[model samples]
Target: MSNTGFRVYLNINRPDPSLVQRFGGIAVASIADSMNRASCISGKIKPLNGAPLLGVAITVKTRPGDSLVMQKAMNLAQPGDVIVVDAQGATDNANAGELMVTWMQYRKLAGLIVDGAVRDVAAIRNMTFPVYAAGITPRGPYKDGPGEVNVPVSCGGVTVKPGDIIVGDQDGVVIINPDDAEDILGKIKDVLVRETKLRAEMPWNGSWVDEVLKEKGCEYID
Candidate 1:
């Protein structure tokens, strides 16, 4: 790798389209539950809209206020790739805005997820593109160098690597290591089934709560 700010790796191992398809319909919350609730992205990063996010991760690690590396990553991204940026959770400067996001959408990218601030909220809200960020600022970003692409990076308290599956929705985003995709998919299916069962019983009283309270040695007070 060069010492330059534009450190990028090409030919990342993207997950199979079929596998990615399996995750697209699953809710981000259900995926997190299947992962034992350990890989949920921090609440600070939220979706810009209700559009669903499901694609292979193109991990980017950049300076808090720089987008040069991010721009490079965007160029390297494929039609269905999700550019996941780790900007150290900086909200003082906007790392991306309307122009940048518009280009991504034009390229048919899956989505953009930034662990830093982004700008142009008004225009972004008007589009169907899925964008998630920790904060928003009009300060804009510097195009200076010093970032890496397609490497392991942390975003919103979770570690993400190139080729990881990124799933997001109204709830939030979750990263799935491709190595565990099959197993996680199986668990997610089970979680969905259980949720369906529980939903069907909503009209009935929740007697299970009483069992739990008694097991914890709770005494009746009245």
Candidate 2:
């Protein structure tokens, strides 16, 4: 109820597309450990379409069930940027529908993520453009004022700011702060290296568990 009128928006720097692009091929589960098992959104949010999402986040904070500010976000988003909407996880009303998604496609956006609900599942599923949401409903959104664009917002369970790298695949979505990209990218390489070696050994490790048990001096009695 506070600040119901237009709030001045902040200018957020745009992140390097290549940095976000680097994550498209990396699995979210693999990077989970590198992120300290944190900085991931709620699992409830997932893609309406199976396609993966990767781009800089153009963050928006909106009132629950409203698409007015979301429209503003879509208008402001650059090509190859993802519109990340914080709708406070509303389920009673949808935050977007087919029309907005179509507009997103026309704008050439990388993807869309709503921390609430959306409609038009069938239409969205028919296409390759990715749309992630917490739920789907027949309900539509309310167009009202009083939302912040290009600002820090919480989508699902993660705090995302403008210019942060956002990547999502079939498994789930994750955010990487622009400031932490270099460190995280290095960790990602390390994780991939370790996983590659472990995967190569998994098929040949039928006795590995029993071998470890023997190493631990465990005895079974029946």
Candidate 3:
């Protein structure tokens, strides 16, 4: 799969809108970096801040200095689509940048996830486009051939397949397998309900630990 290929094995339909909205951008996955805890890379650029991307994915496998397939991904991408590129875990060369992001924005793409670096940081940040990569760099990628797209690829230690629901935000990216959406949605809904009830209480103060300590006969010192 050294070209722009679409994964047909898992063309899961987008999650129900109501459920998607209820869950918001909450999905369980390990954070890419603990320091940048809320910086999630996958999000829906269009539909404004519309509950993140429901379901869509693109897998990329490229060499150290290659981005031919990434260009193809931009050409083939459609609205609500997410381009996921596996740059072979290379951080030296940038596989994506402002130009490709602009193309994706024009196509109404959701966002991009690359296992490598990307350039044009300032411009991309200013634009509505959401890019989740290892980091940014001034060094651009080479247009060499021999990169795969629309295949299973690992990004930031998460395996992604096409049509998988990629929910991300300032919290970081989470890959939900197509077959697991229903189950995960159930869990998410439960969590949301609990959170809602807890928020309504309004008596827990900023620190729940203080309440717990009081219950345990521990006094707070001024």
Best by lDDT: 1
CA displacement after TM-score superposition, residue 97 of candidate 2 (Å) = 0.9
RMSD of 2: 3.1
* Worst lDDT 10-window in candidate 3: 42-51
How would you order the candidates by lDDT, starting with the best?
1, 2, 3
Supply the global lDDT for candidate 1.
Answer: 0.92
Clashes of each: 1, 0, 6
Better of 2 and 3 by lDDT: 2
TM-score of candidate 3 versus the correct structure, residues matched by position: 0.70
On residues 49-119, what C-alpha lDDT tens digit does candidate 1 reach at each position?
A: 87889899999999998999899889999999999999999999999999999999999999999999999
Per-residue lDDT over 3-80 for candidate 3, one digit per residue giving the tens place of the 0 to 100 score: 244322323345454443443545433222221233333332112122344337766667765788788777776677
- Distance from true location, Cα of 73 in model 3, Å: 1.5
Q: Which pairs of residues collide in model 2?
A: none
Give lDDT per model, in order.
0.92, 0.85, 0.65
Alpha carbon lDDT of residue 195, candidate 2?
85
lDDT of 2 by residue, 48-147 (tens): 8888888888888888888887888888788998999888898879988888999998999999999999998999998888999999899888897578
- Which candidate wins on TM-score? 1
Query: Each model's TM-score, in the order given?
Result: 0.94, 0.88, 0.70
